[model samples]
Target: MGSCKDEDRNEINCLFVHGPIIIGAGPSGLAVAACLQENGVPSLILERSDCIASLWQQKTYDRLKLHLPKQFCQLPFLNFPKNFPKYPTKHQFVSYMESYAKHFSIEPKFKQSVLGAEFDNLTGFWMVKTQDFQYFSRWLIVATGENAEPVIPEIHGIEKFQGPVMHTSVYKSGSEFQKQRVLVVGCGNSGMEVSLDLCRYNASPHMVVRNSVHILPREMFGVSTFSVAMALLKWLPLGLVDKFLLMVANFTLGNTDRLGLRRPKTGPIELKNATGKSPVLDVGALSQIKAGKIKVVEGVKEITKNGAKFMDGQEREFDSIILATGYKSNVPSWLKGENGLYAVGFTRRGLLGTSSDAVKIARDVADQWSMINKIFPDIDTKLLK
Candidate 1:
């Protein structure tokens, strides 16, 4: 296998090929590569960006941090630094990904935007084509996480609004909106965190929570809520776990009825298990909402030149709009093939890279390939005439 350095960020050079081809160069890709190497299976990573973990380095908000504790989010063969906080910041996590790649001797081909992949009947291999070159591999893994594409809702009159509308990808800090009236759309984890960040900067921010959602504290009475969850999930049914969690939340945070916050009729675990929409694990947003630092509003009915019209017949003005709406994933678009393709980042099951999923994936793929390589080796990757 050959190595593609990061200096060629702008140029798409055909420098390397052979072995497994992993896409995205994010945590999932790096983790799979690392584990495959451990199993004596060489792989090459093709990343569209110059650097690894483009989503973390470029897309995430400035003040953003991991919602889960650091211990649960570790990749295979590497652990977070001991000094990292309970919930590591985006910067810290990005640094960890870089170190993981380096430590595993994983050098990904940079600036290789995979146009599409197709199984070449002549070559008997999956040919991954970037802008500059095509590389063949027996296995193709799509590790681009869920946020690969931002899902911007079609707001009525959104085009007519005369404010700086931006997605959470480019949103860095709230200091830029100091004293400005801002409307934050959506109520996911990012939305809640961004609203609180604006409050810290004294921005008059209003959040639009369209539906009921689960809100959890990072800790309950000094015990990590995640730790509690792992303990409960082992013994109870998902519905029972949800009830127990709702009880704990009510006990700790009190009913949020007065704050215009409504708990979903369904429990968080049930919602996650059923719909794949993750629960918002609260860090410090609720206290601020209760203190009148951030105002909560109903969903947007429409948009005006200056502000959004709410479903409750209320219209308010704001200087800017920050969309914290989440992301979408269509793995087949990037890693198309006749067969033998795997997706590792964001699945319907949330983030596979955040847990032991990648370890299991690498192990399974290696086991499967050991048999393949023994018999008709290069049967899939045979060079086309």
Candidate 2:
């Protein structure tokens, strides 16, 4: 392998055609890259953003902390700095990701957006295509993650009334909405957190909650909820496990019944399905709703110039509307092949979605590649990195 040193930075050169190609530079992609590096694999990660973990930098709202504890959320070979808070804020998390990339020396090709990829059965490789470059790889890993595309709920006059309308993914801070009547649509973590942030900034915020959600503290009885989950999952069925979890959450954190929105008639009583699976447990936003800090309303049916009209015959006006709607997964769009391409992080696996999920995806990909590695001995373990 040929290495070039530019400004004391070790730049890796792509020497072989059969090396693995990993897409996306989020947690899952980065985790795979770090593991491959440790194994001396020469894999290349392609990221569209100018920096790694673009979603963490771009999409996360102000005052947002990891719903999961720090021990579970940190990626392999990289831990959050000790000086960091227990549950890292959005900025802190983004900073941790930057350090992770630098520590592993995972110098991803920045701004190299993958336009498309296709599997070539004849060549037994994936023909990877981007805006400026093209390559072929023996194995392709799609870790683009689930939040690449923002899910903007369809509402009448969304495009028509349009006064700086954008999804929660595009929202960076609440300082912009000072003294404005802000209508926060959705009651998920993002919705509640953003609404709370806006309230602190003196923005008259109202959360347009469509339904009820169960809230759980990140930690319970001085133990991480993540640890609690691992122990429980080993013995119980998913349905039974979900029931146990919800029961604990509702009893401890209070229910959302008094707010007009009723809990859905579902098995697990989960949040939205972003990454193939449901959110672990809801963090209580009902407190904010009941305290008159954030007004919870029914769903939005339409929108006018002043503001949005709700499904329950309510017309609420706002200076700005932050759509805490959700996100969409685009991992399938990266694979290039005629055969079955394995996708892991695009959906929920074993309950927890984005919370410490990259590690799980990395392990799954590792298992799949183990078989591939046996057949193709020429492919260096470094390529897996």
Candidate 3:
């Protein structure tokens, strides 16, 4: 519990005699912690926020549901309550995670944000430092996730606009945008869902079409598409699968104007070959598009005092704007490492067994953690079960 002095901090590499430190309290972190505890591996978790799954509580818009089914989404030893709905709501997810924490009795030291982590060449342990606390551990699990920071696109005069600007990460409900002409930027699930939520509140929500995205219904033929996609991806090549997905996306929600905005590009948004490997399925958004509840615009060229200027050279006015853009994974500074540091759940989906993220990372962690416990029998990995 002692703060590391600037000089003593220099000896952090030698001070890391602890077993391991898990960062974040989300599904991945909790899962790893449970597994480690089951095995009796001494570990500690450092979380910046007071509650578990803080990101979940902070980022989602109204009526947001998990894209995956409850059955597939539950973590480690825990199962979603039998009474829970098929696609668990955000609140349901938070509750489930809370239960997981209680069941495991994993107490994450709150308000202790990991600022950076570094691996010492002389010692095998990782020196993790935070704003208030510092610890040393042999292993590091960077489970902070990919969507940790809200992504706001830069536009000319975006800050100069008089209207309020907010990102989807902090969007809880649409009641604030009621009766206001709002622009929902980005065409992903967040963008579409936020736009629809605003519409239900009697707000005129305009969608800014950035690119064409694939949207799938939560249930198809009485089964979740998430299950179906998981099954298919297991056997098919990723490239072929991506191509097939593009076709299906085009068929269900045409290439351009799916959200009233035009997309000249027939393919999915251009993500770096490293970044755009895995494809995320979109649901409800597609139905809303066909319902004519949302209006789409090409792109934003600049922001004006009156409103936004589009790439098509048209200016429109809005009382407020919501950026349903995306988020970036923010690793705590304490865990900064040179090598032998592991980052799970931030992978760009590509060829099978290629990288770690999502369900794949969960499975890998389960396997690797088990293997390590077996090799280091004294580490007390039985808590994982």
lDDT for each residue of candidate 3 in 1-385, tens digit (9 for 90 to 100):
3334554545332234244577777776777677666555555777888878888877676588876677767776678899998879989989988998999898888887777687767645577777755676667777677766787789788887899999888788889878999988887767877887887888888888766544544554566655665666799865655565556556655654434544333333233344452234555555666676677787898888868999988999999888878877766534455553556555543212122242343444456556766798555322221
Q: Quote each prediction's TM-score.
A: 0.91, 0.82, 0.81
- Mind giving the per-residue lDDT tens digits that candidate 2 earns over 1-385? 3433323364534233444677888877777778766654557888898888888787676667777667767777767788887777878888888888889888787798877778866656676666646656766778787678988888888765656676788787789988888888877768877877787788888887776554555556666665676677799865676677667666766575766546655644233333233443445455666778778778889888879888988887778888888887775565545453544365554213433454554565566567777896665445433
In model 1, residue pairs whose N, Cα or C atoms come closer than 3 Å (at least 3 residues apart or on different chains), thus clashing, are 124-380
How do the residues 1-385 of candidate 1 rate in per-residue lDDT, one tens digit apiece? 3323233555343333446788878887888899888887889888888999888898887888877778778887678999999889889999999899889999998998888887756645677778877676667777877778788899999998998999998898999999999999988899999999999898988999888878887786676776787788999887788888888898888887667878888888778877888787887888888888889999899999999899999999999999888888656576655566777766555433444567776787788778877986765434432
Give the residue spans of candidate 1 off by over 4 A: 1-16, 330-332, 348-355, 376-385
Instruction: Provide the lDDT at 51 for model 2.
Output: 81
Candidate 3: where are CA atoms >4 Å away? Answer: 1-4, 8-17, 234-274, 277-283, 332-335, 348-385
RMSD of 2: 6.3
| Off by more than 4 A, model 2 | 1-18, 235-244, 267-284, 332-340, 349-385
Task: List the candidate numbers ranked by TM-score, top first.
Answer: 1, 2, 3
Best by TM-score: 1
